[model samples]
Target: MAEKLLEVRDLVTAFDTEQGRLRAVDGVTFEVEEGKTLGIVGESGCGKSVTALSIMQLLPRPMGHIDGGSILFKARDLVVASADVMHDVRGDEIGMIFQEPMTALNPVQRIGRQVSEVFLLHKEMDKTEAWASSIDVLEKVGIPSPEIRMSEYPHQLSGGMRQRVMIGMALACKPDLLIADEPTTALDVTVQAQILKLIADLQKEMGMSVILITHDLGVIAETCDEVVVMYAGRVVERAPVLELFGNPLHAYTRGLLQSIPRLDRERKTRLPTIEGNVPSLEEMPEGCRFSTRAPEAHDEAAIRERPPFEEAAPGHWVEACRFCYAG
Candidate 1:
């Protein structure tokens, strides 16, 4: 069996709003295996990013917190870990690439300072050593003219270059796991492909596990070994990539797959879509959250009580509601 690097069990992340305490990640459970990629797929407001932030302990202070659950990294529970422990773990043991590089990067800092900070903080390297290491990382991530780019600010580089810098920072310490939360968002198709390929190449070179959170199934199909399908703060289904794509059991998963535009289809044919927006936290359903939007008729009991997430096949788990479970 593969070694488990990270195990998140019953993760419940919440925010205290005027409306009251609202759970954004409700009972989310998944694991990342050593040197493998796990993709978390869901629409906006489905708690994908919140789950990532919860793991990193980077949630908005005062309002957001992990209300319940255990995030275990290398057998260590992060939920109860001290601030100092988490600080050590953030970039040294686990690194993260945020969705947007423009917003994530320090606007005023030069590229060298930002990238070298990772080594300075985690590796305890001096200014000269850290600067040299940062340039090496920038070069490794395919940043052209790294020596010159190091002196430039975030606004000086192109979108793809900025993203490459972000990748360099994340991988500076060669962490055991890398959490990329839509690392290619807002980039052109060509740049998106390049960024994904760069990440795959680096993962292979570094031998690190990755938790890739994105709504793009295509990216998941290309890069992920296992897949977790989330809807309304809960994981609706999970399976190996081939298993999930070939034999999707949950209604929500099926809907998402069907919505992907097919090249084999007739020209101008309308692409299918999952109808209805994700329900607001205040209006979230008490039971199987996807049941409200599920097209087929379902048992009323599903609405009254949450259905058990059960394995329908080897390595394939689904929210086992009568109507929701296709198998």
Candidate 2:
């Protein structure tokens, strides 16, 4: 087997609210190999972002907690690492691009200073060297007027440009792993394509592994080498990207695939939508969480117990319901 860059095992993250302790990331397990791209896909509130945050150990303390599981980077246990140690590991070995570039970037600071911070903090480089490297990285990420743009604050750049800056910062240290959470959200189709292409190209050029979190199956198809499908905080299916697109076993995966708008589909036909909203963490169903939204799961008999993640075919795993199995 290829050397694993990062391995997440039975990760369970939770948030304490007045209502109860809500499990946001429940038992998500996967690995990203060196120089490979892994996509985490799910609708909103499915714990995709939380899973990434948990791996980074960036959860807000008062409300959030890493309740269980192991996050191993290079065989070093990150779950028990100190904040200072985590700080050292974050930008130096593991870089992350958050979902919202506007919110993730500091509005008050110039882009250069923000991007250079990684170099200064992790590489222990002088301010001048860090700044120069910042411009170089920005230029490499295809940002125009790199020198001038570096001096501009976050508000001065377009959505795509800001995203490029975010990617630049994440790649600045040449980290082994890059965790991108919905990197292309809200961008036009053209810009989205550009950003995804940039990531794919960079991953190859830099020899970096990536975990891309998004709801769009199209994005996964375009970029990821492997795919993990999540529902109600659990991994319902996982496989090679081509295997997933070619033959998805889980009903939820099928629903997601059908929801993607395709030019090949008959014109003027409305796209299929998975019925029911993702269940709130506080009100997760008794058995398999996805049973509630599953097209053939309207009856109670369809949801007796949570299905085990079983291999339906070589390298393709999914949680299967007996009723759906028969169908």
Candidate 3:
């Protein structure tokens, strides 16, 4: 088994808004082992991105806070660390490719200079050396004319190229773990595949663990070793990729699997979709968050109290009312 690279225990992250205190990541727990990829999947507003930010200790504060829990990166607690300490760990030890590359990159700075900053700041490299190394890394990520691209600003590069630059920046220091929050969101289908392939190749080469956060199950099936299904703010199910695909136990997981478009289908109509928007953080259903849309959902009784997530198989987990089993 690969050594555990990152472990998040009972992570409870919340946001304080004018409305009230909303728990975005309520008691979420998972682990990522070295050289393995753990994909976190859920619809929008399901706390996937917030969880990623919490792990990085990059939550926008005053508004957001880690109320309870620990983010253990190689056994070190990042949740409770000081700002200065976290700065040292952010890029050097734990790298992250934000969901949107355009916003993540500085508009005013040249793309090459932005990528080189990681080496210059953390790796103790001089500007000249950092610039050279940045171009090399960019080329490694499949960017064309890395030396020329380095001097160009963010607005100058295409979306795909900008994303490649983002990947280059994130992987520059060869961090042990990489948190990719919807890394291919803005790219077209062909570009998306290329980016995903690049990431897969890089992960294999570096033996680094990756947490890929996305709403697309197809991407998860292709790139992930294990999968964690989240609904509302909690993890609804988790299992190995093949097991999750072959024998999904949770109703929510089943819905997600069914929602994937299959080319082999007899009728090529519109794809199946999970009904209802994901519940708001302030008004998450009490029991199973997925119960609202699950076809087998029994009653609001399940929503009266939180259901225990039980292991239905070796690594498969699900939370639902016992009443749903009565039939």
Give the C-alpha miss distance for residue 135 in model 2, angstroms: 1.0
Per-residue lDDT of model 3, residues 147-243, tens digit only? 8888889999999988888888889999998999999988899999999999999999998899999989999999999999988889877888999
lDDT against the true structure, per candidate, is 0.92, 0.88, 0.86
lDDT winner between 1 and 3, please give it. Answer: 1
lDDT of 1 by residue, 100-175 (tens): 7888999999988999889999997899999999989999999888999999999999998998999899999999
**Residue 150, candidate 3: how far off, in angstroms?**
1.3
Ranking by TM-score: 1, 2, 3
Give the winner by TM-score: 1 or 3: 1
lDDT of 2 by residue, 1-327 (tens): 778999899998999999989899888889899999999999898899899889899998889998899999998879999989899889878889998788889999999889999899888789999999999999988999899998899999999999999999998999899999998987889999998899889988989999999988888998899999998899988999999999888888888999888887796878889887998877787577777676664456556577677888888888777644432
Q: What is the lDDT for 322 in model 3?
A: 62
The TM-score of predicted model 2 comes to 0.96
RMSD of 3: 1.6
Global lDDT of model 3: 0.86
